[model samples]
Structures are given as structure tokens and as C-alpha cells.
Target: MTSRAAGASLPGLTGTPLDPDQEEARRLLQEELDSGDYRVEESWLVRLWRWFTDLLPDPASFGPLPGWSTWAILGVVGAAVVAGVLFVTRDRWRAARLSPTGPAGAVLDGMRRSAADYRSAAREAMDAGRLDDAVLEAYRAIAAGAIERTLLEDRPGRTAHEVALELGPTFVDSADALRRAGDVFDAVRYGDHRASTDQARAVLELEARLAQARPELGADRHPGLVVPS
Candidate 1:
């Protein structure tokens, strides 16, 4: 009966029944082939999606973000970046506007003009209503006159404030004015300050007073000069 059943089951079978273990193995193998798991291949996009999903938590655990929120966050970040860049550019531009030679004294750097020359330039600038130029020229005159009278050393890089400090004891009455003039020079030269007509006149007046004033006998010596004992 078993042989007859085997022959009837398949035409190639030689009327021989398969053993119980062999039959069970064949059934399991057929089930695996019919499932199509081994024969199917995943596309690159699907594989990439799986990899990305593996890094994230379950979608059910978190609510989806509103579509507008993403753009809002990006816009805020972009604006912050733009503001930071503008701030840096402004600082660098300010630095570029300043003299490259040195401090406030740089206004007179490399110029061999006499104090009288600076005074002439100041007068011309004031007449033309170029108050900024007038202020600068007046400050230069002060610096040049100090060097000529040995009140200040004829040195490069000596700032306006340093010159004022050195001449303060000699010109005791105008000490405060000297300091203020130095501040004004720095503001007009390096800062974004605009010199008014009154400011220009004040600087010119200070320069004139400094020219007429006499330094103390002891203060006449330049820092670079040495007197033999």
C-alpha cells in the first residue's frame, strides 16, 4: 500500500515510500522556498532607510514636529549668524579706518612739516569748513611744537596722551586742557566722532596757548638727551 501510494504521488518515484524523517525535512525545505525570504533582495534606498531608522527611537514615542517650526528654527539661526558676521565686519572696518603707523601720534607720522606749517594747514582747513581736518592739523601743530621746544622727545610712536603727561608739569595751568585735547585728537582720528566748528577753534586756541607758554627750565630737557655731570 505504501509503495502504491508513493508511485501514485510522483511519476519519477520507483514505488518506494520516503522515510518519516526525510519526508519531514523535505516539507520544511519546501515551506522555506515558498516564503521567498532567501530569493528576495532589498534595494539600496530601503537598506539606507533601515539603517537611519535604527539610529532613531520609535516614532510612536515622540510627536511629529510642526512643518513651520523647522523653518522658524533655521531662520533664527541664520539671522544670528548674519548679525555676528556684521558685528565682526564693523569692528574690522573701524580698525582699518584708524592709522596703521601707531597710536594718536601717527597723525603726524612721516611728515617733516614744522609747527608753523601745521598751523597754516589748520587755518586753511578751518576757513574751508573742514573742521575734522582743522582739528587734526591743530593737534599736529601741538605735537610738533613740543618736539621743537624740547618739551617732548622727537620720537616715533609717542602717543598724544604721553605727550600731554610729559608736558603737564611744565604747563601746569593747561594740564587738564592738554589731556582733553589729546582725547579729542584720538576721538577725531580713530573714533567715529565728527569735529564741530567750536571743537576745531578750541583745539587751535590750545595750540596757540601752548606755543606762547614757556616750559620750566628743568622740563626743557628731552627724555632722549643726557647732560654730562
Candidate 2:
């Protein structure tokens, strides 16, 4: 009898058997569904169908937009913004582009021009016997020398003071000389005092020394790029 019962159990194993937990879960799900466990959503498809049937107008009656215009409103706004930005940045951009670039020749050319200007001014001042004007030209010359000969490059980024400071101790004596020259000129011109011939000679000699110091500061020369001095 046990052999017969084993044979029956083997046949049942060959077929799929229902799990007790799964069977219980299925029964609970069916009961919940029968009692309406889920909330029903409104049928969007039915609503859309009803709207199309009841509310949609004939396509042939539809007209184009009222203004019959293209390139309206936003185009004007975009153009105005672009124009404004260009107008604002125009001068600065031009200045930046035309500003000096690289070193050597550029710096030299600028220096040459500056030197010519100062010399012209100095000569005029000398002719007029205006000591103050002469002193200003002398200072201008020093500043020009510092930028043109001392800097490896003549780009627009550096200021006079910065160049002067970078020149180390050499600038000290030169700056003092020019500054004293200015004072001497101020005294001679405004205070009704006269700068003696010796004083004029000393000022010119100091100017020469400062010019000499400029090229010395550019000791660390670069062929085509900016160099540290």
C-alpha cells in the first residue's frame, strides 16, 4: 500500500502544484476586487471623445492670427539688446585691439614718440624760460624710458608706477632726480627764483643717468615675448 501511495505522489509531483501562500493571496485579491478596492480614474479618452464630438468647431472656419505679421515683438527686443551692447562696448573693444602688443619694436616706437614729444615740450619750455615746463617734460621722458626700454614688452597691462617699482633700486635715484627737478622748476618759475646754470646742468645729468638705468633694467630680455625684469 505504501508503494501504491508513493506512485500516486510521484504523478502529482509531475504536475504543477498550487502553493498555499499564493492561493491564499489570490483569494484575498479576488475578494478585495469584488468589494471595489481600487479608486476609479476618470476616462480621459472618453472625455476627449465627447469634447471632440460636442465642442470642436469646423476647421474650414478657422482664420490666421489677427496681425498677419512676422518678425514681431521679440525680434525688435533682440535687436535693441544687441545694438545696446555693441554701442557700449565699441570704444573699449577698439582700444583693446589697437593697444600695443609684444615687446621690443612696439615699446621702442612708443618710447621714440614719447621722447620726441617730451623733447619738443622741453625745448619749448627752455625757449620760454619756464622751468616748470622743462621739469614736466623731464619727468615725462623718464616715464617713457621706463616703459619703452626697461620693459621687455610694451603691452597695455602695466602702469607707470608698476614699471618704476619693477626697476628695483635703479629707479630710486632716477625718480628722486626728476622729482627734485620738478621742485627746482616750481621754485624757479612760481617762487620767482632762478635755477642756476649749475642746477640746470645737474638736472640734465640726472636725466641722462635715469635714461642709462632704463636699458639696464631690461637686462633680462626676451626676443619675442614679455620678460621678467
Candidate 3:
């Protein structure tokens, strides 16, 4: 619609009555929106949707979000960046909690040692047909290792999701081992669930490999471990 044609009669975004500039903006926005799907063309609406989707609020910012002022928008972006950093810095958080070194290498060291002890305990328990103890031991081992290696200083800890993030791809193999063991451990611990001998064996093997591999890599933190520490 022409700017003049799409007058006060046009619907405002919130369905409120249109003011002159609003109507004009809406008309312009509408025109941009109506420019057809950005499919092959990437319409302005699609771009706006993408932009807005990217503009999430900070967790610390709480609620009562405002209109897109430069500062508010910047806040949203800053929040997103902070969230990303926190996510990626999870290993550092855990390590700091444990060793005060915030060193990924040290954390991994702890994880490996912990994993070995847990695996041994779990194997013994599983062999004796004590599923409950095996499961419990598995988790305890991981937690202890995480504390010693990842969060030693912060006994009785928090989420490792944040900590695993800071670890580089090299650390991923060990992390994967921890995650797999964790899953099986959960199934056994959280319920009266039964795992087959094969499943239990798999979990043990993964944990063992992770434990061994971690120490071999040495305590040198990956450059990607992100040190300001």
C-alpha cells in the first residue's frame, strides 16, 4: 500500500489504533515484509525475525524487557555473549571450583583418576551382581573426579555442563567417556532400571579408556581452554 493509502485505518502491531508515524512505519515495514519470502529473496520480515531471534535477553537481566533501544539491544547482545562465554568456560568453572588452578589439564587429571577408581568399583559391584552399588559408585567416582580434577576446591558442586564447554576438541574424547558413563550411571542410580551385561561392560570400557587417555595427555591445558587465570 502507498504511504498515504495505508493511513490511520491500518492495524498497529499490538492491534492498537495507529498514530501517523506508526502507520507510516507499519506501512513501510509491511512493504518490506511483503517483499515476498526471503526464500530465494530473503524478505525483510524474515531478516527481522532472524534479528529478533538473535536478540535474546541476558539471564541476569531478568524480565520486563523493553523496546529495542541501542543500549537494550546491546544489553541483549552482551547477555548472549556472556551466556556463550559462560557456556564455553564450564571446564574452567569446574576446575576453579576444584583446584583453584582453573586448569583444564589438572581437572582432566582428576577426572581420569576418579574414573579409574569408579570403574574398578563398578566392575567389582557389577561382577558380584550389585547393580545399585555399581551405578552409585559410577556417579560418585565421576563427581569425585570432577571435584578433584574439575571442581576440587568447590566440594559439593554444581553443573558440569558449563565446565565441559571450555574444553577443546582434544578433551572431547575424555568428556565423551565421562558423558557416556554418566548416562548409564543415571539409568542405574535414578531407578530400579536394569542394564544388560553388555551395556554395563560398554560403560566400564568407555570410562576406563577415558581415565587412561586423560592422564596421557598431560596437565598442559589446551590453548583453547581460555586462560586469563
User: For model 2, how does the per-residue alpha-carbon lDDT over 1-229 read when each residue is reduced to its tens digit?
Assistant: 6655544522223432333378765775576667765757669655644654455355346666455333554465457656866998998974444333432121122335575577567657756776555654654565565555544245454433343455445455565555455445444433444555556655556555765553333344623323334
- Compose the digit string of candidate 1's lDDT tens values, residues 1-96: 876554463323344344437776587667767777677788965675576546656645658877886687568656765676688699676545
Model 2, poorest ten-residue lDDT window? 102-111
**For model 3, how does the per-residue alpha-carbon lDDT over 1-229 read when each residue is reduced to its tens digit?**
5664544355434433345576677776777577674427678656755776666556456665555665876787668766866898898864333331221112222344554577578889888987666655654555555444542234333323333333224356566655544545444544344666765666556544534444323345432222212
Worst 10 residues of 1 by lDDT: 9-18
Q: What is the C-alpha local distance difference test score of each model?
A: 0.74, 0.51, 0.52
User: Model 2 lDDT vs. the true structure?
Assistant: 0.51
| RMSD, every candidate, angstroms | 17.4, 22.5, 19.3
Q: RMSD of candidate 3 to the true fold?
A: 19.3
Error of 1 at 170 (Å): 1.5
Candidate 1 lDDT score relative to the true structure: 0.74
